[model samples]
Target: MSTLLLLCNQKTVSDTLTDVLRSVGHTVIVAEDVFSLRTKTAKEDPDAVIIDLPYVDALFEDIKRMSPRLPVLCWMQES
Candidate 1:
């Protein structure tokens, strides 16, 4: 029963994962773009962050700086 911050730009990907995650009892908060990432991280203080995107090199550093202790899990899409 933990809250998870989900950062996904694709609508389909976000919707699918959000449903699955919620079914398992996790409270999922979503951020479609980088602009919302900072706000969500500060406001939600989620147990972990799930980045569902093809590229995350630019975001890894930002997430670390915001919440270094928080767990970050990346979900790479198949090509």
Candidate 2:
């Protein structure tokens, strides 16, 4: 299984998703803020990433400045 890095601002959301991914056998690293997100991505180089889309544009801009090849999955809630 591939490692999954999750970037979310909500603690409960990050915890829940981390637990679920770990249960499914993927190593999970959850970051609750932008600083941690950058640090983790640099240190871990995860196979996949899941992020909440609230700050998608800003985040992607930062990500592009840093690493354009990184895989990102922006999560969206359906109303």
Highest lDDT: give the candidate number: 1
What is candidate 1's local distance difference test score? 0.86
For model 2, where is the 10-residue window of minimal lDDT?
A: 59-68
What is the lDDT of every predicted structure here?
0.86, 0.79
lDDT string, candidate 1, 8-79, tens digits: 878888999899999999999998688787789888899998897667866777888988999888867877
What overall lDDT, based on C-alpha atoms, would model 2 receive against the true structure? 0.79
TM-score of each: 0.89, 0.80
lDDT measured at residue 4 in model 1 versus the true structure, 0 to 100:
93
- List where candidate 1 sits over 4 angstroms from the true fold: none
Q: What is the per-residue lDDT of model 2 for residues 1-79, given as tens digits with 9 covering 90 to 100? A: 9988898766777888888889999999887688888788778888867888577777767765677788888876554
The parts of candidate 2 lying over 4 Å away from their true place are: none
Q: What would the C-alpha RMSD of candidate 2 be, to one decimal place?
A: 1.9
